[model samples]
Target: MIRLEGITKSFAGKEGAVAALDGIDLTIARGEIFGIIGSSGAGKSTLVRLINLLERPDGGEVFVGGERVTDARGQRLRALRRSIGMVFQHFNLLSARTVAGNVAYPLELTGAYGRNEIAVRVAALLDRVGLSEHARKYPRQLSGGQKQRVGIARALACEPAVLLCDEATSALDPQTTGAVLDLLRQINRDLGVTVALITHEMDVIRRACDRVAVLDRGRVVEEGPVTRVFLHPRHAATLRLVREAEPDGGSLDAAAASDLGGRAVRLTFTGPAAHKPILGRIARENLVDYAILAGRVGHIRETPYAQFIVSLSGRDVAGAIAGLRASGVDVELQGVAPVPEIEERACHVV
Candidate 1:
């Protein structure tokens, strides 16, 4: 588990000191996949570094596994860092080392294991990451995904309790990205390792996170379960992210949907509701003619979900909206200005 309180970090800029993180408070529960999403300059990488004491905050406290590590020094700090593994956005592998050697490097650095022990550990890690066959391959000879697998194997060499994936899938193609994400999920489940994923891609969050925090301008604008945040994003930055991740091949933007005229509402269906005949049944029952502007049916980390924006005409439009809501569908009136609400996540849970 990780907890940060009033966390603030600033850096020297051309103009002056620039705040990279400001008054941030977050808690990541043990054994959960937590996500931090934002655009560039959201301080995502900087924040992750703070967890491992790679970047000390300008102010506030840093706690890892319930120990206050803000002021830890010498051996204490080194021990704490060893308990938290980190995966980089870029595959920061030693090109000079082969796959097995790369994984063995971290264990060798600890000076706690003998040569035989390190060799056994390295072999097990390579097998765990499905790279046993490529143990002798060099980084340059591997594909992007393979190289990342090597990085992951290296990170796991220490058997850290928490794995910090800072844009771990950002450099790969979509198909490769999905494979990496799936691998992370597998690691989380099989190893009981708490994963904190940092990325700009909403799809990554949707695919991998149990809960998420949306960052904008170095502050957390919203945080909650992925289902709630992805389905009914309450912040402008969060809304934009959901739109960008639309599986309907880019849903109509607010500006684009404005000219459609009829009363428009976005509907979100989840779980069994996603498979129900809610839309057609409600339309007929309420006698409302509907036009779907954009939508898609998909899964968010195995939870079936569907979302669509519909323009409603004919009578009883209100009745139709009510019907959809009564059927477990979340209906949001389109074009309505969003009220930014930061839902406090169960980050404090132990």
Candidate 2:
């Protein structure tokens, strides 16, 4: 639903020209949640603003729904902006307006709907966001989550095909963050709205996004399906982000695996295979004694996955690996993985 090509933007810094984005190319499919993640200075916010032409790029093009919006002007620009909904991190609500009024503000600006029509639309939006009871309340009376809900409702007032979320959950607590992400997922599933999310948190992408693009130093260092990225991150930037999201920096010291004193292998298993007793059964069949040197259990979307650094003790070590591989387990024959950062979301130990 959204595409950016060879997009480059730079700003005048005290020292010189600072490149915020350079040669960025990306495509966000319809009805999917796409996340762009990077550190504080990685230009995540600037890239997002470019989508709505809030900040025009110095080079390349921005397209929405296959229409080139890079050069849109006046009424065309206004219409384009209205079609793309934006939810800010700080819940930029109109302080004086009531929840109902805040949601109706966008519709009021368009002047395309009658009073009754706008009223009905506002009511429905509030109901959809579960804020119907707080319609009469002002932004000051609402919690952070409630205010964000109002912002979401306001953004969706026009039934946009795309929703741009700029650090949408960064301001909220973890519990509230989960709740808000659930709401976004529901919105995407029910409305078929393509969502473009920007964040520095890898957890956010793991929890909600279908695909992800890892931004670093003003360039895309990594991009692909969320499951693939989480399971097997390749780029240094992507690995760093994954490690930062882990407990105790997310990896065992090489000493831990090497000290086990046998053929060490990193075993990766996912989905229903993770739940099966395949590892134990294969070990027994091959007459191997395996010790779990280190491991983690987590979910990729809804699918459960487990990665383990295991030390094998037996004559038929290769046989054990072969058996596991034949059963669809990913086997890597490295004695000591320096930084194995396979991550998980849910707490279910598979």
Could you give candidate 1's per-residue lDDT for residues 273-332 as a string of tens digits? 989888999999988887766666777899988777677877898999988888888998
Considering every candidate listed, which one attains the maximal lDDT? 2
Model 2's C-alpha root-mean-square deviation from the true structure amounts to 2.3
Report lDDT (CA) for all predictions: 0.85, 0.89
Worst 10 residues of 2 by lDDT: 341-350
Measured against the true structure, the TM-scores of the candidates, in listed sequence, are: 0.92, 0.95
Candidate 2 local lDDT, 1-350, one digit each (tens) = 89999999999999999999999999999889999999899989999999999999999999999999999999999988988999999999999899999999999999899999999999999999999999999999999999999999999999999999999999999999989999999999999989999999998999999999999989999999987887688998898898888765766666654566667787888999888899999999999988775677877668778888777878798899999999999988764457565444322121
List pairs with backbone clashes in candidate 2.
none
RMSD of each: 6.1, 2.3
Taking all chains together, the TM-score of candidate 1 against the true structure is: 0.92
Candidate 1 lDDT for residue 326: 83
Question: Candidate 1 clashing pairs?
Answer: none
